[model samples]
Target: MQSQDVARRPAPSSPAGPVVEVEQAEAALVEHYPRLVRIAYLVLPSRMGRCRRVLTAHSLTQRALPRARTPAPAIPSRPAGRDGDPGYALVRLQVVRTALEAGLPLRRRAWPKRAQLPSPLPQVWGLKLFPRSGGADELALDQRLSALSGPARAACVLRGLERLPDGDVREVLTAAGVADADAALAEADRGGAEHRLLDSAEFDPCSLQARPTDLLRRRRRLNATLVAGAALAVCGALLGPPGDGWGPDGAAAPPYARNPAAQAALDPGRLTRVSPTAWRTSARVDFSVWPARGDLTDDTALLRRALAVWARPGGSVQVSATPGTPSGGPAGPPQLLYAGTVDNARVVILHDGLRIARYAEPADGTRGAALDFARVDGAGRAGSSAVVLGRTDGNVRYLTAPWVRGAGERDLREPGAAATDIALTGGVTPPLPSPALTSGPCTSWNVLQLTDGTGTRLVTDLGELVPAGLTAGRPGAAEAAAGAEALRTWAPFACSLRAVRSAGVRSVNAWAFAEQPLPDAGGSAAWVCTRAETWRGGGARVLAQFHTPGGRFGAVTARAEDVPACGAREPRVLAGVLWKSGAGTWYLLAAGSRDTVSVRATGGVEGSARGRLLTVRAEQGARADLKGTLEDGRTVSGLR
Candidate 1:
C-alpha cells in the first residue's frame, strides 16, 4: 500500500527534477508511439483481451502528457538505452503505470481509478483487432507472462522492452505503486519468458490484423429489417391511394422508395418484349432474340405483378438462386421471354443479359408464390434455346425458342432408345420428365432434345430457372450428346451432375482421356475427366472419374473447384487412385492424357514409368503425391 523506491539519478539539465513541457512530452509520444504502445500492450493483463488491450494501449500513451509544463519523476531510464530522450522515458513510465491500473479489479467499497474504467476515446465498432501472430516460442513466452501479477508484468516489460536493469525495474515498479517491488521482481525473474521474446510482434499493438465481427449475424439482422420494411410498405399501399403502386404485384412487396431506377425496374410498361419473328432475323443466337410468348403477355395486371415481384420480392416468396448467380433485380428494363398460365400456376420468365428470372404464383392466390434465378451469361446456339415453363406433378414443360423446329425427350441412360415426341404448342413443349428434380435412387435422366437448323442437342433441367447443355468428347472439340457415341459417354457419368446441381452450370462435357490396363493383368479401366462450366466463367468444376469394364456407375477419384483442369483452356489432366486387388492387396493406379510422356509417384509409395500410366504396390488407404511430364516437358500435378 506504500511506495519505498526513489529516483537515483535526476536529469542533468534540470537541478530540481525532470520538469517536462507539454510540447516535449507530445513530441516524444509521437516519435516513439509504436514502441510505447508495445510496452503498454505487454504490461496490460491478458484477461483484458487483445482487442481491448489495443485500444487501451493507445489511450494510455496519448493521455501520458502533462496538462501544462510540470515536473516528472527524475528517473534515469537506463545507461545504454537507445532512447536518449528524457521526454520518452517520462511518458513511457506513465503509460506503463496507467496500463497496470486498468488491469486492477473494481471493489464495491472502493471507487476505481480513472484508468480502471474503459477508455472513452478510440472507440471501435464492428471489427476485432489483434497483434500479428508469432512463432511457437513467442506463444509459449506469452503464456508464461500471462500467469504473472500486474506489477510483475510491468517489471518484466520494463526489464525486456526498455532494457532496464533489475534495480531500475524495482524503482519503476515501486513508483508505479506496487506494494512489494522486491516480490514482483522475484516472481518475474523466476517464471518470466526469454527477454528477447517479449520484443516479438505478437506483443506489439501498433501492428494489427483486423476482421469483421459476426458477419453472418449482421446479414441475418439486415434481412430481418428488409422483411419488416416490406410489411410496412404493404400496409401503406392498402391504406393509401391507388396511384401509389405500379399495380397489385403478387408476392412482390415493392420496397418503400422513390428512386428513379427502382421505379423504372418495377414498371411493366418499360419491359422489353421481342417480336415472335425476331430470332429468325437476328444475327446472334441467344436469349436476346427469343420472342415473348404466352397468352398472359398482353395482360397488363399480370405483367405488372411479375415485374414488381422480380424487382423486389417479399419475404413470403420462396426465392431460390443457383450458386454464383446474382439474385438481385435487373440493372435496367429486362426482356420478357414468356408470361402465361402453365399447369395450375401463372408463370412469367424474364431475362437480363446475365441471368434468367422466373416468377410463379398459385392459380388461386399469391400466398405461395415462388421466384427462381439462374445465370445464363455467354450461352451459345445449341440447347440454350429452351427454358423450363413450370412443373406439374412429375412432368416439366419448357418454352422453346422460335428457331427450333421440333422438340423431343431422350433418356440419356439408354443410348439407342427411341426418342419420345413432346408436342410443342405455340413454342411451349409438353412436360416429359425432370431428372434433377428426382430424389431416391438412380433411374433415368431425360433431357429435352431440340432439333433446330444447326442440329439436335440435349438440355437437361438442373433444378434451376434454366437448363444446362450436355456434350461429350475431348475438350475444345466436344459435340452434342445426341450422338450414339456421345450418349454412351454421358450415360455412366450422368448421375455425377448431382454434385453440381445448383452451381450455375452453363454446360457440362465428359471426355474419355485415357484407358489404362490395370495392375496384375486385370481388366482395363476407363479414365474420364468431366467439367461443369459456369456462366460466371470462374466457378468451373472438374472431376476425374475411374470406371471398370462392367461398372454401371463411375467412381470419382479426384475433384477440384474453380480450376481449368479438364476445360478447353487446359485439356491435360493426371489423376491417381488406390485400387484393391482380388487378394486384398492395395496398388496405386494412375493415368494421364496421351500427351503425358512419363508418370511418377512419391512420398507414401514411390514409382516411375515411361508413357502415360503407372502402378505401384502401396499400403491400404495410403496417400501418395502424383505428377506427370508432358511431351513438351512441363510438369502437372495430379488432380485433387
Candidate 2:
C-alpha cells in the first residue's frame, strides 16, 4: 500500500534537465545563429569596441555547442516560451554565460579563461567593422549599457534580446554559476535600461559597416591618390574662383557627383507653375493643375533662395516630417503652390503629387529656417481642401484650396458656440490655436471649417503640413464631419486626435459600436471606437473608449497599434473597463458588437453572460482579462 501511494505521488522538481543531443544543438545554433550573436554582443562590454565585439560574439556563439550530449539545467516550466526546443535553450544559455564571463576583469593571480582573451577566428584584415550609426536614442542606450556591470548586462540582454521573464532569467543565471541571481536582476532594474533599444540596428552585429583601417593616411603613397589630386588641381585651375553654385550647402544632401538632372532640380526658374485656369481644362484634378498663388510668386531672387534652401537647408535649419513621409529633395522640379511673405517670415509651399513641403525663412535673413513635409499622395478635391501655411506659437494658419468658397474656425468642444468667419486674403486664413499643441486639458479643440461645392467638412491640425480630415458613422460608409449631430459626436473625442499627431494621418472616423446598461441601474453607457488611417496604407491605430452617462468626456479603455480590431475591414471590437459607480460600488463592465455571441471574464473576477455584454462585481484594484466568442465561432481578446 505504501509503495502504491508513493508511485501515485508526482516526482520532485530537479535542478538538472534532460540531456540534449549534440546534433540537435548544432541545428539550433545554425538556425538561430544571428539572434544568439546579437545576445552575446549586447551582453559584452561596450568598451571592447564594435569590431572586437562582433568577432567575439560570433566566436562565443559558435563555441556554445558541447562536444557531447550534456544535461541542460535551466529548463523552465514551459518550453514554448523559449523557442520550444531544448537545443536552442541550451545553446542560448551557454552563449549568455560565456558573454558574461568575457566582461569580467582578468585575474593576475591565476591563468585567464579562454573567454577573457580576444577572439582569433573570423577576423577581417585592413578594415574596422562596426554597425551603422543610429539616431540619438541609440547613442543614449549605448552609454547606459556601458555604465552597467557584467551580470547586470547579461540580465538586461536576457530580458530584451531573449524576451525572458525574471523567473527564467534567474534559473539560467544560477545554472551558469551566478552567485546571486536576485542581485543581478536588481542591478539591471536599477539601471533603467530601455529594453526596446536592444532590438535596434545599433546593437545588431550582423548588420555592419566596414571602413578601411588607416587607409586615408596609408593612401598617401598610393598612385590612385596622386592621380586624383592632380586631376582636382587641373580642374580647380581651369574653373578659377568658385561661384555661389559651388558654395557651401547649408543642410542639403550633397550629390555624389554633379549631373544635369540634379542641376535642373536645383534651378528655381525651372519650377513648374501651372496657369490659374489650368484646373478647369486639365483631366486630372491634382496638385499639378493648381495655379501658384501669392504676392511673391514672381519674385525671382526670393524664388531662387527658396529653391536653394529647399534643395539643401543649412545646419541652422530645423527640419521635420510627418510619419512615413520622406524629407528629401524632389526627383525633379516640383510644382509651386504658393510663395509669399506671411507675417514676419517668407514662406513657400511646393507639391510633388506625393508630398506637400513647406519651406519658411525669416524675412530679415535665412539664418533660421524650417522645413516640414507631409504625405498627401492620393489627395483629391476634399482631401486637398487645405494646406498649412505658417505655424507659430502653437497657432497655425492655412491656405485654402481655390475651390474653397468659404472658411471658418469653430471649437468642436462647444457645439453651440458661434462660428467665427475667417477672412481670406489671397486665400489664407488667420492664425488660430491648434489642438496639436494644446496642453493641460482637453477643454477645447479648434477645427478648420471649409465650405466647398460638395458642402461643409471638418479638418483639424495635428502638427503636419496637411490637416487631417475628420468623419463620422461606420468605417467605409462614413460621411463628412458636418451638421450638429456630427459636431456633437466629434466633440468628446476631438482631443483624442492628439494621440496620432504627426503620424501622417490622412483621416479619422468615430463609430459607436454598442450601448450597454450599467450595473446597479447606473444608467446606460456608450462604447465608441475611433480609427486613424494613415496615408501610407499601414500603421492604422484603433482606440476603444467608454463613455458613461453625464460624463463630459469618454475614458480611453483599450488601445491597439496597427491592428484591425476597430477598422474599416474589421468593425467588431471587444473591450472591458473597471468603473466605480456614483453609489461607491465597483464593477467590471464589458461590451462588444452584436456579432459577439457571448462574453466572459477571467482572473481576478469571473463571470459569464450571454449576448454582447458582461457585468461582474469586483473589488477595488482588481485585475482581470476578458474575451468574447463571435457568431462565426472565433474568439477575440480585448484590445490592449
Candidate 3:
C-alpha cells in the first residue's frame, strides 16, 4: 500500500484509556530519544565519565511527560540546524538542570594518580586529547575535565563542546546555581582554549552501551546498626536530614551534623589517598618542568624539546634534571639527574645516571623502553612517590612505588646492543658546569637540568626548590619566594609542627590533622580539619574540630595551661592559643612534636570563632584527642 494508505489506516481508533496515552507517550519519546541522550551525555556530570545518558535521559523525559495526556500533541519540529523545537528546548533545559543538581555530588571524589604528561614543545600546550584514542590519553582528558568545578565544567561542555550560544550557556550555568555565569564562562573558556581539538581532525561517535529493560525499579532499602539492644537507622544522609536550624548565636552548622561520615564525605579531588584504605586532605597536582643550563654557550635546543615532552600543566609532579656523577666517581659521561614530588610532599632523588654514549650504529627503529621502579630510601616518606623513565625502546614502564623490584633511581636505560645515535633522538644527556650531586634534607624546591649534543637545558620546578638560592631567575620563582615568606610568617605553627613542601602558589592549599594514637583502630586516630582561615600574607590558620562516629564533638584550641609541663607523663599534651579580632578573624600560635605533626583538611565550612583554645591530649606513643570548648559552648568528648 502507498504511504497515504498507511496514514489513513489510523482511522480505526482504540478506546481512550491509560494504555493508549502511555503508548502515545512512548511513540513521542522514541522519536526524540536520540537527541535527548546526546544532550544528556554532554551535560551529565559523571565523575568517572561513565555513560549515563540511557539512564538519566529517560528519567528526565518521563518526569516532564503529562500524566493525563490527551493523545500527545504533535511536537513542533524545526530544521536540524536550528535549536530544534521550542518545546524540545524547554524539555532539554529541564534535563540539563536535573543533571547538574543530581550529579554534582557524585562527581569523581578521587583522582587516580597519573604521571605528568610530556611538555607541549614547539606548541605551548599539549595536543587536545581525543576520545577516539581510548587509553591513557582519553583517561587524562577525562581527568582534566573532571577536575573543573561543577559550574565551570557545565559551562565548558555547553559552550565549548555543544557550541551553545552565549545566552543559552548563561541560562544553563545560572540554573546550575552559579552566581556569576559570565565569570564562570570566561574561566572555562580560558581553561579549555589550549585543549580544544584542531578542526582538520575528526572522531567517530562513541558507541552507546546496551540499555537495561527495567530502569524505573524503585525499591526502598534500609541499613540498621544494632548497639546496646537498640537499632539506629541511617538513610539518605547525602540529601541531608529534614530541618534547617541555627546555632545559639544564629551561626549555622551543617544540617547533617549528627552524621560525621556524611560530613566527612568530601568532593573526591579533595581527599588524598594516604594508604590502601585511608584518605587525607590535600590539593590536586599542578605539574611543570623547568629546563636549565649552566651557561648560554652549551647547545640546548634538543634538551628543550625533550623537556617539553615531560612537562604537562597541572600535574602533581615537578621534575627537574641536574648534571650529576655516579656515586664516588668521576663525571660519568655527563648525566642529567631527576627528582620527583608527589602532592607537594616527599622528594625522591634520581641517583642513577642515564649514561648516553656515542654509538656508530644504525637506528634500531625501537621507540623506547620503560622499567618499573621502587623507592630505596628513608622511612615514612619512602615509596610515596612514583616515576617512569621512557628509553630508546618502544615499551612504557608502569611504576607506583613501595613494591617494585630494581629499587633505585629511574634510569632511562638506553637499549644496550640495539643502540643508535642518542644525540639525534633528543635523549637526556650531560649538561655544562656540572651540578653538585648531593642529597640532603628536603627543601622548598628542587632543580633538574638536561643536556645533549645540541646543548644543555635548565629546567625550573613548578614547586619551590630547597636552599632558596637555587631558584634565582629561572621564571616564576620570585612569586614563589613571596608566598613562602607569607606562609612562614603567618602560620609558624604549620611551618614548625606540620611537614610541608613548597607547592606552586597556583596550587597551594592547607591541611589540618588532629591525630590521636589509636592502636586498636590500625595506627592513629586522625581527624580531618573541618574549618580554616587563610591569612593575608600566605598560610592558613586552621581549626581542627574533633568529632567521632559515636556522637562526640569538640574543637581544637591553644592554651598554655592545658599543655603538659615539660616532663609530666600523664598530661603530656600539645596546645595552642587563638586570638580573634572583633570581626571574627582568628590567629593561632601553636607548638607540638616536630617530627610527627602535619596539617590536613577537606570540605570544611569557613567561619570565625572567638575565645577558642586548641588543647591536644597527646603522649609520645600513646592515644591523643582534641578537647575544650569554644566561646559558644560547643564541646566534644568520648574519643577513644
Candidate 4:
C-alpha cells in the first residue's frame, strides 16, 4: 500500500505503532482478508448497501482483527483451524464484537420506519466459498435476516455460520450492546438459524456497484464538515455572549429557538419526552412538581425501579424527577446511582441518599454466580444479596436468592431482577418471599447402582425395582436382576400417565425394548428385555416382561447362544404384573402333584428358570382364581 493510501484509510485507532509490529499485523490481515471480509459482509449488508458493504467491510476488518491492533505481543499467529484454539476463537469473537458495534448505530437505516423495498439480489464478488443455495427459501431467509436487531443478527451469523458455542456467542452479543444475550439467542432460534444458516450463494455482494470517485467525494465532504465545525467553535469562543438570552446567567437557547410563540406554547418543565439513546448520557433536568399526579416524586418504589431498569446493559429508560422551586427552597441535584457493567461499583447518594437503586447485569462463570449487591436502609443499616444468574437455551433467567450473605432474613433475586416490572403497594414492610428454582423441568433423574462385578454404574431411567438377594446362582434371580438393569438403560420413562398412548387394537404388542451394555457377555451380545403392552379400552399399560440374559445387540442377527430358552423359538413372558383399571380378562396356569391338563399359552413366552412365580388374575363377574405349582412336576393349573 502507498503512503497516500495509508493516510486516507479510515481504520479505527491502533496502539502506538512500531514498524515491525505494524508489518506483522498488516501481513496477518492480508493473509486472512478473504475470510474476514466475508464475515463483515454477511453481518453488515443491511447497514450499508452492497457497494458500500465491500468498502466498509474492509475498514471494519482492519479495525476488528486482533492481529491488526498489536500483533507482536498480544495476539498469536492464526492457528491451522480455529475449532480447538482458544486464541483463534477470541480473535474471531473480537471481529464479531467490533462488527456488531459498527452496525448498531445504523440499524434503523437498514430497517427504516417507513417501509422500504428490498434491494435487488447483488452479484457475487471476490469469494465463492459461500455454501450452495438450496433447501431454504430465499424470501423467508431475507425476512429472517431483516427481522433481527443488529446485535441479534451478529449472534445468529456467528453461531450459525461460524459454529461458535454458547459461551463465545454470549460474549460477542453482550459486547455488541445486546440487552440480553440469552434473548438474542432466542431471537436467532425463532429465525430458524439456530441450526443452519443461509448459504453464501444467497448473498450477492457485487450487485451494489460503487465507483472510487464517489467514496473520494464523500470523504472530502466529511473533511470539509469537520473543518467548518472546528472553525465555528473557535469563532464562538472568541465572540462575546448574546445579550438577549433566556436568563441573565446566559443559559443556551431552548429547542424552539426560532419561534418565541412555540417556546411558550408548552410547559417545558412538566412535559418532556426523550429518545432511548438520550437516557444513556448524563444530564440534569428541572421537572415540574405534580404532587396530585403521584408520579416518580411521590412514589419512592417507582423511582428506584425505574433507575434499575435504565441500569441494564444496552438498556435505556427515560426518567423525570420533580425539582423543587424557590417556594420550597433551593433544590440540590438528585444523585443517580446505577450498576456499572465493568465492575461492582456502587454510587451512593449521600445527600439524603435520594437514589440507592440496585441492579445486576446477566453474566456467567464463577464471577456471575457469586455477585453481590448492598442495599442501605434509612438508618444506615445495610442489607446485601448474592446474585445467581444462568439460563438454558435462549431464554431470560429469573433466579431467587434464598439467603443473602450478611442479611440472611430475606429471599430476593438481586435488586434489578424485578425492577423491570415493579408495583408499589404503599406498605412500610418490604416483601421478601421464598425463592423458586428456575432450573427447568424435574423429570430427568440420575441414579447410580453398584454392580457386584465392578465399580458403581449409572442407571439411565426409572423402572420397577428388583427384590434383594437377586443375584448370580440364585434360581430366577440373576435373570430378574439383568432384566431390571436392561429396563433402566432403554425404557422410555414417562413422568405423567397421560403421556402413554393407546397401543393400536392389537391384543399384545412389543411397545419398547430394554437393552444394556454387557460387561462380560462378549463383544456382540447385550442383555435385552422386550416389553409387551396390552391395549384395551382407551389406554395402554404394560402386560408382560420378557428378559433375555444376553441377546444380539440390535436383534437384527442373533446367535444360537445369545437367546435364552423362552426367546429361542418365540417371544417370552416372565413373572410380571398384570392389572387393569376396570373390567378385564385373566388366566392362570400352574403345575400340581396330581392334576394334569393340556394347556396352550398364546402371548406368553416360557422361561427355563425354575422357582415359584406367583401371579393373580381376575374378571368383573368371575371369582378371583388362585393357582400354584406343587413340589412334584404334576399340574395344579387353576382354582377359583
Candidate 5:
C-alpha cells in the first residue's frame, strides 16, 4: 500500500522548487532592505538605538526569506499582470527609495544603524547609486555619528558626506566635522540649488561653534542700560530743581520787596539843618537869627511853634519891654524892645515909632549874628526890585535892594487908551467916523477904538474882495449879470475888507473892509481893508488899521488872505448884513438896504401931478419924453 500511495503522489516534484522560490524572495528582500532601513533611520534619527533595532529586524526577515518551509504566501499578488512582477518590484524599490528621501520611517533595525556609517569616497557616487534613500539618511545618521570622537566622528560624517552637491560641504569638512548632519539631511531632500545646499551644510558645524553667547547677553544688558538712562534724563528735565526760590541769576526776584511804602515819614523837599539856629516852620519857611541870648537847644519846640504863629498869612504879633527913664542917648521915644524866637535862635526886636529892627543869634555858639530892617507903617511894598521909600519927589527918599542890590523890577501895566469916566461907567464908547472919509459913495466900513490913553483907531471899507483874487479876472460881464440876475445881487455882496493900522494913520482909501478881534483882547481891535488899488495892481494888498477905544488911528500893510473876508466870493450871498462888534465878534443881520432922497420945488407954473411916463425906441435909435408938474400942479410936456 505504501508503494502504490507513493506511485499515486505523482513522483514528488523536485525539492528545488520551494528552495528556488525562497532564494528569489531572499534576493529581492536583501536588495531592498537597506532602503527600508534608511527610511526608518530618517524617521527616528534621534532614536538611533531604535533605528538599529528596526534594521536588525529587517535583516532577520531577509535571512528567513531563504528558509521558508512552504511557499511564502503567494508572494502577495500585485496590481499589474504576472508579466509585470519585475516591474512591480522595481516600482516598490522606487517607492521605498522615495520614502527614504522624504525621511519616512520603516520597519527595520540593524540595517538603519549600518546605514548611518559614513562612506570615505566622494558622496556623488553613493548619491547616484542610492540617490534617494541613502543620501538623506546618511546626513541624519552623520549628525548622530558626530557625538563620537575623532576617527569615529570623522568616519560617520565623511562616509556619505561627499555625496552632497557642489559647494560649502567640502570647505566645511576642511575646517570642522559635521555637528548637525540631520539638518543637512533635511536640506538635501528639499532639492535646493546644489551649491547653496552644500554651502549651508559646510558652514553648519562652525556656525554652531562660532556663536557668541556672551556677546548676546552683553547686548541685552546694554539695551536695558540705554532705556534706563533715557528714562532718568526725561525725569530730570521735567521736574526741575526742588526748592521754591530764586535761581543763581535772580530769575525769581521777590516782587513784594520792590514796592515802596505809601506813607513815608521823611520830608523829601526840606533842606538839611546846617546849624542849631537854622530852623524851619511847618509853614514851609526857613529863618535864621543872630545875636541870640539863651541857647535855643532846650526850647526848639517852643521856638518852632512861635515861628509858626507869625508865618500865617495875616498874623500880627508884638514884642514889648518895660519902659525906662529917658537918657540923653538917642532922641527917640522909649525904645520898644521884645524877645522872640526865630528858627532855633532867640531874637530881639527894637522898635521906634518910625522903624523896627530885628537882631538874632544862636543860643548855642554854633551860628553867627543876623540883622533885618523893616518899616513900621506896613505900607511899604515887598518886591524883587529896589524898594523906593516914596515917589521921586517925596521927602523921605530911600531905595533899598530886595535881598540883592541890582535885581530890576518888572513892569506890569497893560497897554491901551485910558478909559474916560463916561465910557467906563456906560460900558460903551462914543462913535466917531474918520474926519477924511471918502467922498460920494462907500461900499463897506468897520471901526475900532482903544480903551487906554494910547488913542488908536482903525477903519476899513467893504468892497473889492475877489474870490481867487483879481488875478483871476471876473467872468464876462454878461455872465456876471446873469449870475446876478439868477440871484438877487446887492452892493454889500460885492466884496469883503479888513484894515490894520498903527496909532498914526488919519485917512485911507475906501475898499472892502472887516473888523477882526484884537490879537489880544487886552489890546485894541484891528480894522483891516483891501483897497481897489490892490486888485487893480494885480496883487492882493492889505491895510491893517489899529484903533483904540479912545479913538486914535494907525496903519500897517499886511497880506490880505491872512485876514478873513465876508461875502467875498461865497456863491450864495443870502440877503444878510454882517456887523462886527468890539473885536473878533461878528453877527449877520438879515435885513435889506433902504434909500433916502431929497427934493426941492423951484418957482414955476403951479401944479401938482402924479402919473407914469413911458417912451419907446428902436435898439439903435434915441427917444425922449419929459413929464413934470407946472406951478399950478397941472400936467405938461412931450418929445419925439
Candidate 6:
C-alpha cells in the first residue's frame, strides 16, 4: 500500500575534542546545533548538565564523542531535494565542517587568551578589526572614500566595518551610496560558486552615479569665488572718480552763486535803507522855534534862561523833542515841546520855525500869589493854612493864610479859626507837619506833663490821689512828717520806709525810698513809683510791685490735669516754699517759660496724710527745665 523513496543521505561527522579549531566549531554550531549550549545554559549552571542535555537531545555522544578523542559532532550534510524539501543530514554536516574550519582559526588567532569561544565570530571579528577613532584620520578616510561616490562609501563602511542590520544596509546603499561595493560584498559573502558574481559587468553601478559631496563642495567653491569677484568690482567702482558727464571737480556748485538773480535778492542793501538827518537841540523860553530847527541864536539864549530857572536848588523839569518829519516835508516845527507849568497853567508850544505862543498863565506878580495859594493847615489846627515862605528872621515861616471862598487866591497873612498852614509853591503840593511830642501814655495809664526844658509833671494817682503810699523828698519838716505817716499806714509790715532828698540839690528835687512787707505776715510785697524827665523835654511815670507767699505755706505740687485750670498766662508755673520734713527732704517746683511737668508715685506711702496733696501747676510740653515737688519732700530741679 506504501511506496518508500529511499533518498541517499551524506555521512554525519563526529564531534571534535576541545582542541578543535574555531572555524570548525562555528560550522558545527550553525548547521547541527544552532542554539544547543545557549538553550542548556539558560536552564542549567554546570558544564556537565550542558554536555548531558546536548548529547541526550541530539543522540550525539554515542555517534560523535564517545571517548573525547573524537571531535564534536559536525553539522550533517543536506540530501538532494526538490525546492522547499528538507535536505540530507550528511550535506548539513559537511557544510558545518567547512564553515568551522574557516571561522575557528580566525577566532583563536584574533583572541588566543579567551577561555570560551564567543558566538558570531565573523561579525565580532569585523567590528574588532575596524578602527573606532573619529579624529583627523577618520575625517581623511571619510573624505577619500566619499570621492568614490555615495553608494561606494556606504557599501564599504556598512558591510566591511559597521556590519549594520541587513535592511538598513540595503536601504542606505540603494538610496544614497549607489556603488559597485554592494555587488562586491554580496558576491564575497555567497559561498563557492557565487563568489564569481563580483567580476560581472553590472557591478560598476557606482561609476555611473554622481558624487553628491563633490558636487556640493564644487558649488560652494564656485559661489565663494563669484561673491569675492563681485565685491572687488564694487570696491573698484566706489574708489574710482565720478564719471559719465559729471562736473570736472565732481561736486555741484552752490545754488545761490550759480544764479545772479538769487545773489542779488540776498543783498542787504536791497532789503532795507537808512537815511541821515541833522542833529537837533532845544530850549524852554523861546516857544517860537525850538533850537533844533529855529534861529539857532535866539533859541540858544532862551535855553540858557530856562536852564537857570531849573538850576535853583531842588528844582527840575524835563523836555522832549522829535528829530524827523514824515512825508519828506521841510522838517516841520519841533513836532512836540513841553515846558514846566508855572502856577496853574501847563505851557505847550507848537512853532512853525518862526513864531511861538505860550498857552500858560503869565508869570507876573501873580507868581507870588500862586506860591501863597497852595498852603496847608498847621499841625492839629485844620483850616489855618500857612505859606512856605522863608522868614526874615532866619526862621522858616509857616505863614498863616486867609481863608477865601470858591477857587480864588487866599491871603497868607490872615488865616481862619485854624492855626498856621504852610504854603508849598512851584511843583510842591502841601507841607508836612514837624515832629512834636504826642500827648498819650506809653503803655500804662500814667499821665505825663512836660515843659520846654523847664519842668515836668507825672500826673498819676500815686501822688495826691493815693495817699496810702506817697513820699516826697523835701527839706521842710512838715513834708517829712507827711511822708513818714503815709509809709507807716500803707506799708505797716515793711522793714524800712524813708524819704531822702538829693544831696547836691538844695531845691529838694529827687527822692529815694524802699519798703518790703514782713516775712511773718505772708511773704514780702513791694511797690515802687517813679517820676523822671526824659532827655526829649518829656516825662515818664512807672509803677512796679513784687509779692511772695509766706514761709508757713506747704510745698506746691503739680500734675498735668491741674495745669489747664491754673489762672496763669504761661502754661507752666513756679512753686517755692520754706521748710522741709527732714534735712534732705524739701518740696520745690519750678518750670521755665516752655516746659511740661508730670509726676508718678514711686514707692511712697499710699494712704498717708502726706500723700493726699494738691498739684499747683505743671509745664505743658518737653522743655529744658521742669519743676515740681512730691509729698515725700523731693523736687524736680531740672531735666536729667
Clashing residue pairs in all predictions, respectively, total 0, 4, 50, 9, 88, 47
> What are the per-residue Cα lDDT tens digits for candidate 6 across 42-65?
111121122222222232211222
- Which segments of model 1 are wrong by more than 4 Å? 1-261, 583-585
Candidate lDDT values, in order: 0.81, 0.80, 0.29, 0.32, 0.27, 0.25
- In what order do the candidates fall by lDDT, top score first? 1, 2, 4, 3, 5, 6
Better of 3 and 5 by TM-score: 3
Which tens-of-lDDT digit does each residue in 1-640 have in candidate 2? 1112111122322276778899988988898888889989988877566888998999999999989987765465233434567778788878877787776655446665677776778889888788877899988888888787767778888887777899988777766656667888998998888888888998888999876653322442254458869999987876686676456778776757676776787778988999887877777776667789989888878777767777787777767776677777888888899999886688999887788888887664565678878888888777888899887546898988877888889998888787788899878998888888655578889998999877999999977788888888877778888778777777777778888877788889888888899977799988888989898889998899998888888899999889987777887899999999889999999998879999999999999899999888899988888899999999988878
Task: Give the deviation of candidate 6 from the true structure as CA RMSD.
Answer: 55.6
Q: Which portions of model 6 show Cα errors greater than 4 Å?
A: 1-485, 489-543, 547-640
At residue 485, what lDDT does model 1 achieve?
85
Error of 3 at 165 (Å): 1.9
**Cα RMSD for candidate 1?**
22.8
Task: Please give me the total number of clashing residue pairs in predicted model 6.
Answer: 47
Q: Least accurate stretch of 10 residues (summed lDDT) in model 1?
A: 1-10
lDDT tens string, model 4, 83-169? 343333334544554555444321333442111122233333343222223344654665577667655667677776666676766
Winning candidate number (lDDT): 1
Output the lDDT of residue 567, model 2.
75
Per-residue accuracy of model 1 over 267-358 as CA lDDT, tens digit each: 78998988877778888888998888888888788878888888788978877777667778888888899889897688989998888899
Q: In model 2, where do residues sit more than 4 Å from their true spots?
A: 1-257, 281-283
lDDT of 5 by residue, 198-314 (tens): 223322321221212223224534665698799999878766777643445356657565323211111112212233222222222111111122233234443333232222211
lDDT of 5 at 413: 15
The TM-score values for the models, in the order shown, are: 0.60, 0.59, 0.26, 0.25, 0.12, 0.11
Q: Is candidate 1 or candidate 4 better by TM-score?
A: 1
TM-score, prediction 4? 0.25
